[model samples]
Target: MTGWRRRETKREEQIIRVLQEPPEAIDLRGARRWRWADEHWRVWLRRSATGVELFTRWQESDEYRYMLGDDAYQMQLIEILTRATPRDCAAAGFGCTRRMDRACSEPSICSRDPLPAAGVDPHREGPVPGGCDSFYGGDDVRVRFSAGNRHQAVRWSMSLWIDGVRVGAGLRLASSGWWLDDRFFVVPAEGPDEHPAQEYTMGDLVSVIHSVLIHDAALSVTRVLVPGPEEMWTEPWVVRDGDELRVYPDQETSRGPDRTIVLTD
Candidate 1:
């Protein structure tokens, strides 16, 4: 028999509450869109029924969003964006796609190499030495970029940005960031594992989420979704389909039920 049950900390208790029921989503239709940009990122803001919606365009590439609620949050976010500046390294990643592909072939070397200018090759002088860039978010959102570790296998750390401010407590595994709507972004992450670490059959891993992280920009809070006691889902993927979010394993052979959550209030 297990000795004594460990008491959940305030953070753990909050995670439990959020897993039981997610925070409310505010409607964003008919909202006004505002724009802000610096050298590296472009930001778009739209004020909704009860909060604001923020979208980021990364260095002429991908776009993602964050939804923030409450009236005061908007003013604060704007002030931060207005004062934001670009990092010297921010431009290093702008056109590194081809370089990234080449670097990944030997990631340790790529991650630790120095960044070359847009049209230059970083691999010319053996493996470029030492780190790379930084990223910043706009209007109720925050962004971070890591200059991969040379000594260890590369994995990303979870970082959260709120009201254009960076908060250090979010977790993300294997770099999963899926937007649930104009406001929420979901991240599949590492959770509490009571079982001993050992190899488990794929069959034993489906239907469980150590935890699922959902950022409610409207509430400026990061919410977590955990599984019930008996089932643990492995390598889950969250996808948005019209008014609903579905969480399921990415593999085809896994025998697990897909968890669905409705986005409409």
Candidate 2:
């Protein structure tokens, strides 16, 4: 997986640029000449009626079954981690490209990188193991993340990167919501502090998860929807407070009008 990031040669650039344009079958012959025989790509680019579908193509591979085990919820963490509500960007000094959209398209204009902490290197430092955990803490990190399931309640954990790969203390307190747990580090999200009588749904919570992933939500309020919308809510935010790891209210978080989320409001 380490080499996967470095293989972006001129040919890949050409293919990507072309794929970004129209829907058509691309010839692989030209793309091959740019790479060594050992350069392998696990991703597939398929032309669709709308555009292209880029994903790790493993349907026909021997590892297809194993790869299939990847959780859809877990895979979405990356996008969610970098997402923000349109209001968040607006309050942070950005105007709308489209009116009434909940999400913001220009994260760059904002000065804050809300995910847990900032300056997370997208590049991993070491050679990745063939059978590695789903969530990786980069640079022998003080922070940790894990592969977790929404089904399991009361089971999650977290960690903080202190200094130069020295991981700080961690905390674990499971009981609901989506979490990023990789055995060593677990960060659980809190559900909306809605009254039990009011019928808050998983979809509502997932929308909140978008905020949570972006590091733009209440840290103490970390939670996740459990076991397919049964509404078995849990709170799993149990992390030690430190410079490397600090939990607080998202300054950009703005619920509708007259918000009274006791856990937050």
Candidate 3:
């Protein structure tokens, strides 16, 4: 009598062969490998009572380096070659490891700060004390100031440019007490159309305010909240000057004790 049994298919056998052998033992010498598609080095292994594993490393070509920076590529390599325990791997699913997943899911670590919008001044300059740069689409721009002493203040000003023409300015304030005081001014692009959009494309030209300084608190302006553009309702804008103000189309204006605006023709 023959007992009924499910036999492993040829494909499964191939997988088993690749998995059971040590990755270092695989022969990759003299293979016709494509620069982008093929790995320069590889390792294969099988856990004693679990599934299979594969490790691969590719040569860093100029194209790859240009596409993904060196740091990012190195991080990717670290994530792939390192292996987790069988239980950790099994919990994640076949062919997946917890470490790899965690590494992949981690957010980018960058050290940059956001720039003030056009027309506002933070009044004080090095790195925005605690401000960080924001990533919107593919643009990576920032402005920050650092002070020499804990009691000192740092100021930043941004000048806005559209089509290479100066349109408005923004100011940011950073002190020992508060790291960032943001302000903005509205300079209509093409005279304000009813259907305005927030999509920024190449060659659209945007600049920040003019000057930023790092000096004693006595020389720095006090913290003030300025209103941002009318379209950006929730973002507060502040000023560092004490005596001037201006209004824009479809926008309301507010004044504060420590803030002011100086408009130019």
Using lDDT, give the best candidate's number: 1
Looking at candidate 2, what is the lDDT of residue 159?
27
Give the per-residue lDDT of model 2 (tens digit) for 1-265. 5577557575689878998986544456434332311112111112121111112121122244355554543333223222322122233222222322222233233222233322122211111211111121122111122232111111113322211121212322122222222121333433444534224335323323211221212232232222223233232232222223322333222321111122222
Ranking by lDDT: 1, 3, 2
Off by over 4 Å in 2: 1-57, 61-244, 251-265
TM-score of 3: 0.17
Better model by TM-score: candidate 1 vs candidate 2: 1
After superposition, candidate 3 runs with Cα above 4 Å error: 1-10, 25-265
Better of 1 and 3 by TM-score: 1
Q: Give the C-alpha miss distance for residue 252 in model 1, angstroms.
A: 4.4
lDDT of 3: 0.26
Give all candidates' CA lDDT scores: 0.38, 0.26, 0.26
Mind giving the per-residue lDDT tens digits that candidate 3 earns over 1-265?
1232224465678889999977552245324332212111111122212112211123333445577887665444323323322221222221211122221121111112224441133333212321222111012111121221122111112332211222223332221122222322222222112223333233322212111221123233322222233333122233333434422222244432223346331
Of 2 and 3, the candidate ranking higher by lDDT: 3
Which candidate would rank higher by lDDT, 1 or 3? 1
List the candidates' TM-scores in order: 0.37, 0.20, 0.17
Q: Candidate 1, residues 4-82: lDDT per residue as tens digits?
A: 3334365688878889985444433212122222212211112111112222223221322233434344444344332
* Lowest-sum lDDT 10-residue window in model 2: 44-53
Per-candidate total of colliding backbone pairs? 12, 22, 38
Ranked by lDDT, the better of candidates 1 and 2 is 1
